[model samples]
Target: MSELKNSPWITCFLRPQELLLLLMLRWAIAYMEDPAFPHLGDSSQPLPRACPWRCSCPRDDTVDCAGLGLSVFPDNITKAARHLSLQNNQLQELPYNELSRLSGLRTLDLHSNLISSEGLPDEAFESLTQLEHFYVAHNKLSVAPQFLPPSLRVADLAANEVVEIFPLTFGEKPELRSVYLHDNRLNNTGLPPNTFLGSEAITTLSLSSNQLSYLPPSLPSSLERLHLQNNLISKVPRGALSLQTRLRELYLQHNQLTDSGLDATTFSKLSSLEYLDLSHNQLTTVPEGLPENLTILHLGRNCIRQVEAVRLHRARGLRYLLLQHNELGTSALPAGTLRPLRALHTLHLYGNRLERVPPALPRHLKALVMPHNRVAVLGERDLVSARALAELNLAYNRLASERVHPGAFRRLRALRSLDLAGNQLSRLPEGLPPSLRSLKLQRNQLRALEPELLAGLKKLRELSLAHNRLRVGDIEPGTWHELQALQVLDLSHNELSFVPPDLPEALEELHLQANRISHVGPEAFLSTPHLRALFLRANRLHMTSIAAEAFLGLVHLRVVDTAENPEQVLVQLPPKNKGALSPKG
Candidate 1:
């Protein structure tokens, strides 16, 4: 045939079977235009339908599939998914047509799955009519999930086991705005009244850790942050938030609220309330129609003994007044009762029973946490009008360094932290405020340290004489040279048998743990070169009494604790190219 098609052994065996059938018909037209190649009836496939191969189409409309232990629901998802993250999967059920062809789904993050409201199907999300932000938070939902999707706007059922919230379950969701039912087990007859009647675009309403004693008078006057904290809410019935007059933040803290279940005209109709957490409630008194544009008033652990200046005369823009652990003493605040709080700046009367130090306060008071009171004297007018006092926690009071009166913190010249830890101080309390930078005299009865007891404290940086009775000749020689901004030096449970030489070269943390330190002088931390934490735990050294240049020039020594010392005391430090000490246990 045409001379056997110009015969060269039939052109090398039939043109190698026609070049292997034209490379198998061009790889079957690129495997039918690979839209992840499975659909064989290719009607002009250009490649767009893929997405669910253990999900992550980063953009042709997002399908994240978080924590893929996905129990089900990832059946080739790409119907042009508009943000669909099945978060922390093991997703039990959502099958009412399982995302019914994702009608252009908009943000559906099934958070921490195991979805249960009897396995979600009251028309499970009714074919998501362009759903808007629906995170099913930590699921196993007991109720609150009805037809939903009137194009819902942010409905996170937080830590769910949602013990009922049915009335229209967000009543005709008028584009609902932020409703997180927090840690659910919701009580008070499981929320009924108009359960958010016609939610006029709600603005953040988290019903916190529930077992709610009461709070459903149809909230949502466009609520502006109302987290009902850890509830068992012992009554708030007066018009229960009177239509939330644009509430500005009201977290009723660890509730069991008393004072006969509060009704100070229900927070005086929250005139745009500004942050009010009635802390651990059982209130003895202090809840009177508050909200004169209140600015932060957390009444700590209540039983508030007395603070009546007409209950803070209409809170004139009060600035942070947390009355800590109540039962306030020493005639419980009577003189001018905090002088009408002129924009008071932070005054937490710590674990109250105050014997003194709370007169007139707030002259722009900057942090005055009155620690475990019964104040036994600290004269100089006890912080004379707090000259903008910068943190002064009178720790476990009953002060005793001769009852501390000499210049008692000289008008607190903006004192920077001075907590006389568990007091009864045996010394060192004179003048003090050289703008003191943290000096907590731990478990006192200080046995001595005298360089005029830390002369003028050159901006001392954290020096807690741990469980004091410090001894080794009671530290007198250059007693840590004007503490050159000493960085953390707590001589733990002191009776120091040694190690105290010059010390402060900007010493960074040296807590001699339960000390009886049996000698370690190789210049004992020689001028502490930025020494990084060296806590000699329960000492009595013996490894030839430690002197491998005893941690020489500490080159930023990183944590060294010679554990409970004498096991023949192997102190061994000098390694990190001759320094960076690491033996911390």
Candidate 2:
């Protein structure tokens, strides 16, 4: 057998079965050396693909060379690479001759580069016939690139110095769907009426943060989302949107639009419109003749004084309404102003002049955010219709504890989070919903925390009473017993002389910073064995006042901050693997 394995003519002296096995071994060796057969016995286990230097190939078809700071494009790019990302570089030009070599290229991203219009020849992208997505945003192009590939679907040219767009800049691109040209120098005269006429399939066009002073007279009829915010647009002619029946979302915030500047019938013909934003304008009333299918409307930061239900009568499907930072008063919002909007889910009336909660709110509302208003009281039946209410934010209001009706939040069974911070409440409000999980009462005049205030709050996990007048005796005994699920308790910026007792066992973080705490007893954290973080900065603590066994029961404590104390106290902490004490500064 040894002689047969070494001899070149072994097959001549082998038996019939042995001769057949030798022939099969010779055939396998030849197959292994063949270049066409690159797999290791199975096609699924192919060799690794080629990758270029200073670039990463996450997939065989994708190449990411972003944030390499390369002044020139890298060489040796794979021919089969379909997606090439060269963003956040200093490349000044794109060599079309070399780029044209990638015939199968589908996406090319050069965003945040120094490429200018002079570097892009008229036929710079004509050779990339298979290209679909082209991103050149944050460049120095003074003019948009003409002769774009006909197969392009998304074109991003935002954050450029572009001042002009030729009539054929986006022409003959039937597959185009989105065009982003925001943050440019394009004005009303710079955009020709026929610039996008040939791109019939365009659905989203963003022209925000521009120098335009008026609405474009002509736009693509197939646009579904049109963003024209942060412009100088002051007027919308009668037929400005007459042909945009298929439009769904329109953003016109931070413009100079006024009631007199907008024609009454400008947006009446958009039958498919669902979202419209006219915030930060000079309108004194809601726009009339809104689309019937409109669901969300943003009319905040305007000069509007009243909201006539007749103007919103057409928008029966409206769900989200924003009228914050306006001149709305008690008489501005009538009782039935929002009754017609049965589908309204969220309403924002913050920073208004209203003295009380509006009546006849939507029944199915989920959130009512009216912070920074002049509301002095909450009526008992104000929220009776909104049984599905979950979040209520009345922060920075004049809500005193006595003025808040006992049953104001009784009907809101689904209330989960309530923010009443920055109020004049000396005591906790009564009749809080038992389903609440998070309650914020910071920056108020709260002096006491009675046990009855938290009787049914078993699901409450977070309670914040910072920046209040709370004292050690103000918190009644067994006050925290009802909050079995409490994980975070904030008593910072209070008059507590020591750590409060009876912290919940599930408490994980305790914040007592900026307090008058002078000592910590050995049993301070006995009930909170699972505490992970403790903050006692900016207090009157001394090194001798903190007992050696103060944190004995806290095995999971990870962070203990006692900086800015009277004597720079540093407590002995657990091992490094468990936790460490933050150094005093």
Candidate 3:
């Protein structure tokens, strides 16, 4: 012991208190050297502490206390947290001077909470100078915050009871880019004139689903996308959108806009505009002076009676045009009205009073939906220019099979989906497009699918013939043999006494409900090995009539709806066959 004490390194045995202090000093030095350690003793930065009890520290700079039912903020939150999420919680208020300690916080999500106007004190967000994103949507705040951090880039207060926004709420933040205040109660009186005048960097704004009766003229010039749908807006003042040259998208659907309410030059200055939706209004004619760069326009569900060709002459780059549910007739659209839209791809004119297809359809049209019209004939030249058409929906039209020209669709090599349901067709249309992948013939008059009708449709995937008078003999043995890729077959509500034979080998879903089928043979589905869903409900299927080997080869079958039959089939099945039967109605 005397020799050890005499050594240089081990001078002597010190007291316990002094030795403990020396060990702590060594640990403090190592802690300070660590690059991940948060600096201590900085008055401006909070000291690092242990993670809160009910919270999680997924990363060194993130704390998540979401959906914890925390009415009061958790304690011991580290000051180094940069992303704190307390959404979907019962937190009604934040403690004063508590959140101000997180000086490095960049994003705070408190959405779906009970934070009211009084609960969110101004100081709660006043100290967060570095905060860039703040979300408090789906809350009970009746008014917006009077002040926000200047560094905020996005503020989402949607689905709140906010009826008023202070003048300085969003005007002072120069760096603010996006503000979502949709589904609020703000009206014209509640919004000041200079609400968004100072935020020059603002690009996206949403004020949809509000009670505003007119367009707000206080929008920032840098806005790129603006959503104002589902409002009481009836008129758009001239130059309301003229200065928004950089704006690309404008949604004004579900409003009370009329022909007289809009100015002739309302949309002439939006040179960069690409999308404009003015559907569900009271317009009697197509709006004039549309933007030249507009690509997609929605004017459906209106009182439009005519489409002036000269008004759309400048929209040469239009790709999609919707004019459904209007009062347009065959003469409303003049000749050569749509020839200028060279880039047009889709045109919808359904639910109209047209007696025939519109003249001078665009040559590059890909989809034409004209269902629920008064057309009685499919003329030869009706679709001659639509060679690039891929989809044609003429359902619920007053057309008969005899009125359709034999070679009406012969040149359409790109046609893939055809809907001729709810027509007076007695048989399948001859010379149907071979590239067809879907054919709907339900709610029609006749029966008997000719073998040659679908002989070339090798790529057909869906065929619906429900609510027809097709019998067992109507569907021949090779009716579906050529459809090598067919996967869905709906023959429900038909006059079939038995299941049709020779189904496609790749059939996966078979709907034969509400038929006159009385018995199921053992080889009913022996050819379809890939069948997964079989619907045989509301038929004449009985427990004893269905052969025991009906589902022998169906290894991958998951659903077998046999309800509404004469007897319970699933209950009578043996214990070993229970897994194969799922009674889904």
Worst lDDT 10-window in candidate 3: 2-11
Per-residue CA lDDT of candidate 1, range 1-585, in tens?
A: 334333446335557778576556556766766577757466664655587886778788887989989898888787788888988989888767757678789898989989899787767566778888989899898987766766778888899888888766677788888989899898868788778777788899898998988766778788899899898888888887886788889898988888878866888987998999989988998988887888999999989899898888999788889999999999889777887887888889998888889777767878888888899987877678768888888899888888788887877788888888998988778777678888898998888877876788899898888998888787889987888998998889888888788888897888988888877877777788788778887788766777888776666676677776765455555556355444555
Candidate topping TM-score: 3
The true-versus-predicted C-alpha distance at residue 384 of model 2, in Å, is 2.3
Residues 446-484 of candidate 3 have per-residue lDDT tens digits of 688888887899999999999988898887778787899
On residues 1-585, what C-alpha lDDT tens digit does candidate 2 reach at each position? Answer: 444345687667889998889977777777776677777677766777778788999988999999999888788888998999999999998887768787788999999999999887767576788999999999999999877888999999999999999876787789999999999999988898888877889999999999999888788899999999999999987687998889999999999999988765988999999999999999999998888899999999999999999998999899999999999988988899998999999999999998887888888989999999898988898778788989999999999999999999888899999999999999999999899999999999999999998899999999999999999899899999989999999999999989999989899999999999998988899999998889999999887878888788677887888998888787877554254655435
**Cα lDDT of model 2 overall?**
0.89
Report model 1's TM-score to 2 decimal places.
Answer: 0.39
lDDT of each: 0.82, 0.89, 0.88
Candidate of highest lDDT: 2
Candidates' TM-scores?
0.39, 0.85, 0.87
Lowest summed lDDT over 10 consecutive residues: which window, candidate 1? 1-10
Task: State residue 174's C-alpha deviation in candidate 3, in Å.
Answer: 2.0
Give the 10-residue window scoring lowest on summed lDDT in candidate 2.
576-585
